[model samples]
Target chain A: MTSPIAGGVDCDLHPAVPHLTSLLPYMNDYWRDQVTTRGMTDLISQSYPVNSPISSRPDWRPVKGKPGSDIADLQRQALDRFGTAYGICNPLYGVQMVFSEDMANAFCRALNDWLAKEWLDKDERLRGSIVIPVQSIEKAVAEIERCAADKRFVQVLMLVMGDMPLGKRHYWPIYAAAERFGLPIGIHAGSAYHNPPTSVGWGSYHIEDYVAQAQAFQTQLTSLIVEGVFARHPNLKMVMLESGFTWLPPFLWRLHKFWRGVRMETPWVDRAPLEIVRSNIRFSLQPVDAPPESDTLNRLFDHMQSDELILFSTDYPHWQFDGDEVLPKGLSPDLVRKIMIDNPHATYPRLTVKEMTP
Target chain B: MNVQLRERPQAASSTGIKSAIADCDIHPARATKDELHPYLAKRWHGHIETFGVHAYQGMMEGPPYPKAQPNASRRDAYPPEGGPQGSSLSFMQKQHLDPNNVALGVLNPLNTGQGIRNQDLAAAICAAINDWQIEKWTSKDARLKGSVVVANEDGVSAAAEIRKRAGDKNFVQVLLLSRNVEPLGQRRYWPIYEAAQEAGLPIGVHAFGFGGNPITASGWPSYYIEEMVGHSQCQQTALASLVLEGVFERFPKLKMVMVEAGFGWAPSLAWRLDKVFSKLHGEVPHLKRKPSEYIRDHIWWTTQPMEDPESRDHLFQVIEWIGWDKLLFATDYPHWDYDEPSRVLPAGVSDANRQAFYLDNAKQLYGIS
Candidate 1:
């Protein structure tokens, strides 16, 4: 009977919107009428199919309603159970999938409001991520501008696999806005399904889509670095949530190798990709993909070179681990403190500011 | 330009490989653009002259992500006799094969018509390239073996070509690009796998192809580095598709070797698949075994641009998870990201593992012995 670690900051907690209709009170009157008149039901992203074991831990799951819908459950299971000092709410509603730009923006606004009022307001330990409708760059920036003033919003949220790679110049405005407010852009796994989940084409099994998330994260990481996103936004930090980090060492080796060989094409990339990653990129700690043995996990950590890269997270109700074994076995007590507290504080400046405020 | 593989120490040391060595990936290029023209029919000659192959990438003449260096080859690799890297057989032997003591080298020729949109043209070009590999490579050197390049999009035709080359010593395996119009596991590609199984040849899915899809799950990336890194991701999707589509169950005898793309992700990829499989096995009732079991049995990977982690043993851990025998040594010779024989396998590898990784595995997989 081991004790759970206390005072850790949980970086990724998915607070599910109970149903599409629940956002009605938060939505503008015009959009509320539009949603009801259109007869919209659930907009759950297939990425997290309800009832999939990975969608929610069997033990934490409720008898009814959505897996991550209840604030009380999140507070007890995710916050108190793990002794988390703060838990960031990254609502995984299918607002990113809405085809209509107008619909996506409206829903994104409503989702942000719902997150603040229902979840953040309920728990002082909870923080919010601004879920931007990324279909239109201008609107995405506008949403960021609207949400940035709310000090409770700690990060800007986007899906890992969107219609375009996240690094395109068009999307820089949103990054710029987020940067202005010291908000790190958190890229979570799952796609818009605007394209096939896999690079080649769609796969038959749900597991195939799940496996492809790591690959999608790698592509976006490459996109972010090689497309000069890191170079352009020198101080901006990008957090990859639910993105596995075991593949990082080799990925950096391969990317750094090519960047050296072909520096002429993208001359703006003045420093090594690995250096850039160490500086600007932060990865969530969950879904440890290395073999379960702590020795194997530690060896991968050795490969990671920097201990500061990983921040702790339960990936709440996501069934990434069995019980309270959210932190993999191998980490040292010092590393545990950094992963759970220091790293998350460093990556998310708002957490530090809020902690300092009171 | 500053590659040290060309100048890496050649002396056989205590740690050096003592037995036979096999390089599973050696990309042989064309000296000239019309090198395979003579192998093609006169009908294709005019089509080639006028209607060029339609590719999925935006650019018709060059790759979507422009390669960092010309031909994406090592600076030292271009033959003094004046042709592209790997274009001259003698240069390969002098620079890589003989020096590295490669006893068996498999030729994987790229920039072929195998992936083009026109099925007829792709078929003709594939056959021509197949014939050309025999005349220009295998016939000239017994150390090398050829891969039967096929029009992978046209499954029936790809199978026919495999059957045509079946049991032929000139070719040791069938070659399919990682990226295709549809995931290779689709019924569209089963014919090729079936024929390869019948032929007793492993199908090598080297990482490069375009099926009109973006190089990434998102869309076209900005740099060649992304494409290079994207190779492993593309192969991951390929393996996932093949596993979940029950390609292994349908033709259990068909073996696959993922070439060029690093194999570090295999164990984790399989682990995730198996983890999910335990819950969602009902979705794929056709599968008799777990996804890892299928992967462990049927899939093999070649080492090139090998994972150079901070701790060398970290790679060994992945190799341990992905069984030692499943890895075949590859140099990806003449390419800029070539993995030299001595340099790739980090220190502390046991003799038995090294023997299997460098020689025994490829020999058994390709039946070279």
Candidate 2:
């Protein structure tokens, strides 16, 4: 199949790099001390080890007649398979690096720089999320300020599970920085280090725990909206990343219900939760393998107040995802265009379509 | 009261008596730690201590777990605190069990001694929790039914407890939290099942983080958020274990209800299990029925954190996969994510399906009529 370079932008992609070894120095001293004391040095180890088949080290050559493991090769595969024009590359470290505040910040800075130099520098179509050390607000804001000047940095990436609630006032600084930079903040599910607060206690394993991350994102998003973060920082755009979109409709309804009764508690929240979401929130619809029916998606759109809220994401390399071809089959062409292209263009305007023929 | 009885007869004559639904997964407010402590075993003092006020923190570490910013170790890790007190339960009752809302609520003990591996201590703990629940919740509310936890590690003891509690009008089911039990069909657990079957109490299998089961997720998530998401897989595994082991065949009258496990994945899991059974039929010929059929005949499910907007459609899809009668509505109260019964049902659900899911199905399952 020929790759179609439609002007559409794929909002979720990952540019793989040797895990966060490069950014170790920029972390806060306190976080560095914590990691050293806790003996959690190996936290950043990728699921694939150095000798593993998926590892894409520079020195490793593909066996004769075998496929290579380079970032460019993966990008080529995505381009060939998805007809992707430009993609907002969500790096792996940002999701996985959560041990000490220092380690997280350093890793994010390193990953952002590597992303900028390797992928963004090489192609105008390759935009990136600035991975901020969310544990360290000062470093996170500093990184956002430093990277926002780069046109390719379109969003600040955060993992949904963390030490503080996303709506907590401590996170205001990061939101303010994103607003200042005109960058949307992307919150993805599944981090190796922290578990999201579930209604139930943490389950025994990864699959069960990871599944809660999406719910946590919903809760966090609700926290952010209901706590008046969105109202306080009106310009900040938030994207729920990697989590599936089906559960959102009920969540919005529940939020509105709470808003009605508890408006007194959060009087600063100028509008209903759904309205805030409609105006500011964008969700990336990835792994659409379990995408709700068109009718369900349509109802959700109605409830949330806009179709522009759902953006397209591939969650590349994740198993059990709906490939690009399968994504557009269930939706009308216009909705498909909005999910796969226009919504992302509207959210991240700096992501320009590049002409690439394959 | 006489007028109401006369009115009931007249109402019944007019509407043809709709059966009352029994919610098998209701939770009443737990007794205060001070009230409950006197009844519990001394060793179990630590369990409540670590868990705090809720007794069962569900999957959450009650207190003294590493906080984001730690100052000092908490007083006791055994019973964590700062959870649902009396006020929280009052809020839950107001929201979930208002007469204008859901008419009935079944109270499940938060911390049951049955899941602990120590048989003697487990039994003592179970008894204390049941007593505390009865005194604090069931005694005050007729809308509530009780689920008694028995010592599962010792089936004889567990069965004895079930038998003893079976005759109690307030007790409706035997509550077993998911942990490292042998498959439900195994000979070891059969005594408890038999007692429950004889008593006409359905088995309630709720998920927990510790004991009985190994954590299957790849890594430990640092926060509670990761743990909650990972619950569905555990639910699936538990149900699959019970089904594949022929638990349904061994106890035809026994009903099993999965709680807090969302139904979104049920349709797919049931379909996949049936297909697998078709391919591996030779492996276990003792199971004559399809897995989905067993589920439909014997299994029930409660909806909470009811994935809204699509709540109706999601329930419909599962009903389409299993049968409509197998679905039940529940509000896992006192927990932070408790679904408000009044608002849980989306505006889109058809009346017929709503009646089945919200009322009729549970009525039949719990023999409310």
Candidate 3:
């Protein structure tokens, strides 16, 4: 496999929060007191099973701490090894799992502050996604507004499977806020477990759980398009993080075919679903979930006419791919460059500004 | 098998006459619930009038996401004679079978009550549907064939139903729903498979059933669009369950056909299953082969709402991954998105592959001569 060129932007890198106590310092006095008094330090890991082979790459795991907790280790393994000039840190924690809107908001605030201070502040190459409390739209929008002030926070992170379909009007404020600040909404592959991952119910093993992520992404994409999220917020960008890309071409095809037949129902969706997906939705590269054969990837790329849809993501500490195999083998050099750097720059307005600056 | 079946494609292509097509998924619904009343037992006829259907799903009218049209079908598909879409054999012949040059059309009548909770009721309704198809459709048109509908929830009865229709040439395959009480591979459903294999019939699994579970893992999807696209996901789970649980290993001769659920995901699903099964083979010790091997050897996919990739070449690649011989043509007749046989395949397909996809594949699988 060919190594990615230097100066590429890593769109998805998980910054681990070791323990609940770690974020306690970042919380406000009232929230800090509430945590101490309530003894609410045991935050559950939302999607990641700590010991899964996929949660941490064998090489990236630290000798002492949780795999992604150490900043120096991440820099050495992800940034230095892949030659990623800019890496976006998406902190996945159990903040979205909290039921109370107030508590969820408090945890989200602490999570963002901790991310900004521990990861983004320590490394110039590091950028972050503002972790928001998606349980309540008002608080999510407020959180987005609060974090948008810092250009280092390039995107807003929402779990792919949430309480309601992400396209409903209740969630429009969050999309509107992200669009206003020119920030893309990053829907990462994690679930709140509000419902079973499959419509039939939960699967028996992790493989079923892991495989179901692609299906979840499909549901969200269709929901967003049909609910008129794109038509309403024309300038918004939806980046599907760690969601496999190969399944998309077929899903879009099915979507478009049905759209042609049922366009009368969703009248606002004027164009074909494929056209809308190309213009609005984007997918991350790693966990390619495709046949390793070069011809398969080539045909997939051919199906995905636009090269800009895929942004380079190592998904650091996540064992999606092995060694320098971050970029799938068959891509041409031009396509590689576009995925690693050009696509990220185009997707995130903040990244463009960073590149232009001295 | 008929020698003319292979030559028919070439002859039809060369002549102005439409090419011979074998539609593996043509839905034929009842004009009214009362139509099945004659075939149903006296008890069921009274039950239908009173309580109505008590399916596994929350609502009996249909899926939560109301179809684009009244039966979730194309508006124009409603017959000129004024019955619900797909209810009239004469209308189907004029609009779909005859116009499309469908040499053999396999009827998958879903309204036969597969999802109903009461096994006896579901079985009774399934039997009535079979008798109804013979009287209304297969008997009326020599070109039309039927799928033996069964209450998959109760395998004993389902096997019996399969056996009852096995000798009849009009019934080609045993039809089951994608959504069921349990994953199809489990021992509960094995009897149905045994009956099918013994009878030398392929099991045709059409999408849409009330499996006593939400349409999605995340709960009922809010929109019709999400529910529609989800048809393939259900099939993916079923195929994985069938392979991993060793259904193919136990019943080697059993042929399975996935109809209506698009074929695009088959390649990815097989790859994912094989990739995981390689490392986790211990979980399913009964399997002797890779998941893809069983899928390739046993399972056949029908192409309707056939994947239309942005690049036509991409769809060709998908077709290649899913071998031409394993693919059977289906139009999902009278549904909102029926693919016209002539227009479905893109330019890159070779004449031989095209002939096999439209006719020969289904003929060999169903033993149609």
Candidate 4:
């Protein structure tokens, strides 16, 4: 399928960078240890095994070689397939491994440096998220500070699952730094070692397991709100990545109900939970289609209270979802343009506004 | 006005009904220690050890069974303030009645311990819950009604309680949650159904999790969504048990409502059951009607956390599969992931179906008049 650029911006395209291995040496030791311990070190190595594809699924496999494992190959595929002028590359190294605070910081710094050297420095269209090990507040903050001056670093990427409640005041230092640097906090779902909220023994099958992932995202989001993180860090912007938007409407209403009654516990929150979410929270809709007849996308738009809150994401190379036409088929052209291009541009203006035609 | 009248066919059908809406699932506050201690026969006090609370807090907390993510930030943990005062009673009045949006709310027991173990306590607790609901909720708030929750573990005691509470004007149904009991068609539970049918009250089968049961494929889920989504599966299991066991046929008037379970999965199950039964009629000759027909005639469902986006088309598909009247709208208020009435139904749903899903169907099922 030919990838069509919506409103001149192909929001789903991702650029890849080579030379990530060279920068890996500069990564924090804690992250290196995490990659080894979390089994991600093995998984990453296996992805590029000589004979086979990185991901076993045929749909996710690259045309000839493993495109996902090599940053340069990934960029070539993006330009060739989608005619993408620029792309936001969420690196595999930052997300696939679980790192301690120190290691997470080092890994993030190394990845950011590599991104700057290999993609951001060379390509006008390339933008990046500073990957940080969220476990250590100090390291996460330092990494954010290190990347703050870079024009291509659009946001700070943090994996959502961890041992402590995300809204806990201990993480305030990172939020303070992100806020200071004017960088949005991008939280992606999925972690190698951390037990997500849905780790509860809930279902017997694959559908049940996938549903559990959505639930974990909801729980984490609620923790961020009820724990007063949004209220305390009013300027902090958060993007809930990977989780679909179908569940947000009901969750928002319930959160508001709890917030009204539980105000005594978290007095710092001046407004209802829904209001806080609307003000600070953003969600990326990837793997977007679900039973097309359900009109899920439209309802999600309504439930989110604003179309602007949802940004388009393709989760490229993942199987189970449409390759390029991730958005619902029947939506009016206007709605498609908003979701595929305008909304993301509005949220991450810096990346969206960069020179693309050249 | 003519255009509005044309839009609501279901509401149009309810011109003579007493109320516009009736909620099928409402849980009443449990007895305070003071009210419950005396009702406890000496042997049951030992059972209280299983649940740490001394009768009163047990009632306030609802079930003693812990959810997958008990500490996860949940929206349902706090109830709206300034609406009602008593722990259980206040929620009904404050959340359901005061809003005037709900005309009649059916009440269930908060504590399921009586149903799980110690039949005597279960019977006593259910009885106490019904009477307390009547005294505090139904009597003062005309919108409140009651369900007779019997101890599923002991059918005899459960039947007796059903027989006792079925005749009360305020008690309109029987409450049997999805998680606690054996399949509804099991011979052990027939007595309770018989009693409920004789009393003219439908059975309310709500969803819960693997409290003591090791039935879940893999233990329990660690997250609340997993627990909540699993309710649909439990509902399917219970629904199948009841249908295949001929609970609907044995007690023809014994209607049941599957609460807090998603409705999208219902039609597929009905089709699957109907298709399987057609080929295997010899296996279960007791069924007088097709499985799908039985569900349309006897089963009803409540929608909370109503799977929006899907709710629009899915509700229509379910209504087409069963009939237009099988669904009832609920808020599942004071719990996390509560559905807001205004926001729940999608924009494109016709007004007639919307009214049916939102209110009228529940009234018709409960015989609100």
Q: Rank the candidates by DockQ, best first.
A: 1, 3, 2, 4
What's the lDDT for candidate 3? 0.83
Residue A170 of model 2 has an lDDT of 80
Using DockQ as the measure, the top candidate is: 1
Ranking by lDDT: 1, 3, 2, 4
lDDT of 2: 0.61
lDDT string for model 3 (B1-369, tens) is 111233333223323488889999999988876888789888877788888888886775766678876786777678877889999888887777776788899999887769899888989989999999899999999889999999888989999999998889889999998888776666788999999999998999988887776666555666777788877887788777788778898999999999889999888778777765655576567889988899999989999878876678777778889898999999988886778777888887789999999999999888888
Worst 10 residues of 1 chain A by lDDT: A349-358
Model 2 agreement with the true structure over A1-358: per-residue lDDT tens digits: 1122366577777555543333444445765565467664343333323333222322223343122225666566565466677778887653345566765666666677777777777766678888888777898899899888776788888877666567778889999988876788898765544432333233332233333454556556666775678778887889988666655654554455445534655578898777788788888876332324565444434544567888876555443232344363346667777777778878875565232211
Q: TM-scores across all candidates?
A: 0.94, 0.66, 0.90, 0.61
Candidate 1 structure quality by residue, lDDT tens digits, B267-359: 768876776677678778889998989999999999887876556767777788889989999989888878868777877988898899999
Predicted structure 3, TM vs. truth: 0.90
Per-prediction DockQ: 0.61, 0.06, 0.42, 0.02
Chain A TM-score of model 3 comes to: 0.97
**Interface DockQ of candidate 1:** 0.61
Quantify all predictions' global Cα lDDT against the true fold: 0.86, 0.61, 0.83, 0.58
Top lDDT model: 1
Error of 1 at A58 (Å): 1.7
Give the alpha carbon lDDT tens digit for every residue of B55-126 in model 4. Answer: 311333543334332322133333455221234555545444555357777765545444344455657666
